[model samples]
Target: MTSEVSRRDFLKASAAGAGFVLTFRIAGGATSAAEAAGAWEPNTVFTIDPSGIITVHITKAEMGQGVGTALAQIVAEELEADWRDIRIDYPTSDPKYGLMLTGGSWSVNWTFDALSRAGAGARHLLIEAAAKHMNEPASECIAEGNRVRHLPSGKFLTYGDIVSKGLITATLSDEELKKIQLKKPAEYKVIGKWIQRLDVPEKTNGRAKFGIDRFLPGMVYAKVIYPPTRTGSKVVSVDDSEARKVKGYISTVREGDIVAVVAENYLAAVAAQGKMRVTWDKGPHANVTTDSITQDYWNKAKNDTSAPSWVDVGDADGALAKSMKTHEAAFWTDYVGHAPLEPMNCVARYQDGTFDFFSGSQFQTRAMGDLSKLFGVKPEQIRVHQQYLGGGFGRRLEPDVMLEAGLIAKAVGKPVKLIRSREDDIARDFYRSCTLQVLKGGIDSSGAVIAWKNTLVCAYPGERYGGLDKQGRDQFSLNGSDHYYDIPNQFVRAIRAETGMEVGYVRAVAPNYTFFAVETFVD
Candidate 1:
């Protein structure tokens, strides 16, 4: 939505708390902005200024998902604010935001209720203030089109007019916010209707800035020469004498098995990295191949009996055993990479005691925490200037790529832009683990599925990220196996396969493979 409000106006409104500054609590029980100044929650914080410009600061990562638009609509629908007056802003990562992550399609679903209340709360205050100004009963006043309308009097006050008069001062408590009546589904005016996506204009006009588009003055370029194995190995030696011959070549920074070749520009860095000679002690995993991983999954699925069932219903074992009509099938899926068009890139700067990361990250909170732990600094010392991502598909969730840029920047003592070549990006990607699913289905005489059994084997995606539950089960490895069918008996279990390599979540996570096995077996 287009707005005449300038950036100066937004800043002044935020500073003065001009109109209603609505704040909702985010995850991890973080307090609202009104409760504590700096202890801000990662919620939809929208400000209605004196000019009637509504600025909604969306904290979720907007990686090709219209989450920004959807969430804004949720606010506008309840606030009765005009769509054209809305403006969206992506805020940077901070402890106040509390676990800024964008994945699993959780952005809108988790925030809908909270944001609706915030908007409704602000609207309630606006109506009260408008009733006082118009000398009308608050019950008869309704908020619509960014203004308060008195039904009988046929008079209205624009949100800007009421805000400019400094009339809305009452705060909405958690209890009061809950008591406010929200709009019904049929009464929704902004949500569910197709409005122009907030990010479409900037994206279509090439004005959207991705992680790779970020640049700073005097920032050098870096290209990483990864260890021979994807899991990483120790560096044996480095002979960059030949790389010195390349034009614009700067130097090399080494951390463990990884080496970053720095140069004046990306082209120079790539050329120099190609010329440089570095030997790696590719550990035991050097011999780990796709075939080996697949075989490991097969072995685990066939023999691992101690593996616990992630989803168990009724008596699947008895049904499959007693049933005469049974079908069994095996499905295998190879490792798939999240090869987003933008590849992996980040601009990092470590100056004084602060570490700045200008990157499009899906998990900004994790990235900031990772860099803080890696550099031995407090979380407050790190700043993540979140940018738009070309695509995520679960790749940007990992902080390894961003960590490399930070490590390189700190080594050189200058702002460094690390860009990965397409080849390098694919080669070093944390691929979706190769998975094997052996499914068995038992059908009745009437051809209805009576029993279902599935044994999935794959390297746990969460194993590398410390996401495993107490029983040592990674949900990503077993998702989608628990079918939604009305089958009376179903048993789904997972056997962990040690691929000795890091695996990650891709587009649909485990469902991509799990559903294939389950549906195919039923067929």
Candidate 2:
């Protein structure tokens, strides 16, 4: 989806200073103007006040990836604003923020150009206003150091001076915005250079806020009693009389398989949770074990030729039969957890059909949608406050913690904060799928590889989230197996083993294991 900042209502006078706001206008799927008139507020990246204070609205989560610093640099490079004068703040979950996802290393790559243009657009307007005030040609004026200078006259005006004299508001049409010029690589001053991270000082000084650190007024601490089996488990009974006797214990809530103990404080919550007794009907997956999954995948890799072909070129069987030299090998990898530094935690307040959620989510937009579905409200009714993630590693992408917090708050009719213990975090994780791969290659008399055949058996990640694509294949399950080499005869196939466990993306996802197999086989 494409989005552009609407310049029509661009400049406004702020109590702090003369503020410039860039309203993001979504192209195709945006709500109509009439619908947005009352409910929608423009999405702005940066605002400059009369005091020269610049507030940059950071849209992505900071997961030790330097995304906040990199995005700020993009704006500073083109806005001609001093980096030290800029303040970075995480934005609330809004449609205008556009895709608040932070996985696959896409934060900088996707936003670099858009943020640069936003800065350049602000700089352009500042220069235009300065040129008019000085009665000089706009062409001869250049924006630098928060000031616009005339090359010939050597006279300049500070951003504050221009705003105080009179605010000039102008809007750029969609066509004009598209035609705006961007800086070349050689003109970049902030992007390529190393700037101290904006979050480093806060983190080092122990002032950074993570999901687990989230606290709100009147919020109670809660801990869930998750079933031994994460999926297909139901709560049969709950005995909370002993838990209620614990000091500071507020209530025990049971919904589906989750039994949460709520208390006045974290320690009290933990103590009460231990005292509560819960019985679970551990459905079909109770008998599934790691050893059984490993053996099943290995067996499938050897015998399941009924699996669909991921890639096929020429006749690999015929080529391997004719070749004099052939080598075959099999590799196995076990399931692994993301193991982020902080366990899953989320704070939620549900009142009068509105829910406020606080967490460091990698997929904020998707999480908002998930909450809306659970709460049975519009997406706008849910407000997600983003925070710093202790570590993501693809784990924070799931919204399970947020959902749990919301459910507990709704059940108790009060603000609730849910913190998962280390055991709960690991036990309930949708782990990386265990994989078994077999590779066979044929070499000619000249020692050149002629034929290659690969077979993969693994638990399906698609079954956990959205199912297979239209091609009826889980691309992530068979990723990195499509070789780029010029092999005339090659075949790649994948079989989905029923491991009775959920699978998810961890780090580089399936490619991490798939590439290892391909590289080791070739070597």
Tens-place lDDT per residue, model 2, 232-259, is 8788899998999999999888776678
Candidate with top TM-score is: 2
Off by over 4 Å in 1: 1-44, 133-136, 151-155, 312-318, 444-449, 464-466, 486-489
Candidate that scores best on lDDT: 1
Q: Candidate 1 has what TM-score? A: 0.88
- Residue-by-residue lDDT tens digits, candidate 1, 1-523: 1112233443343344322234543322424442232221223467666678887878778888788999899889998999999998877777665556677776776667777887887788889889998899999999899999999988999988876666665666678787887889999888999999999999999999998899998899999887778764888999999898889999988876668799998899989999888888888788888677776777788889899888889999999887869988888888888899998889999988898999888877667767777778888888989999888988988888778988889999899998888898898787887888888889877888889888888877675454467788877678788878999999888788876666788876345788877777766
Every candidate's lDDT: 0.79, 0.77
TM-score of each: 0.88, 0.90
Q: Please estimate how well model 2 matches the true structure, expressed as its whole-model Cα lDDT.
A: 0.77
Taking every candidate in turn, the Cα RMSD to the unseen true structure, in Å, is: 7.8, 6.9
| Model 2 RMSD, rounded to 1 decimal | 6.9
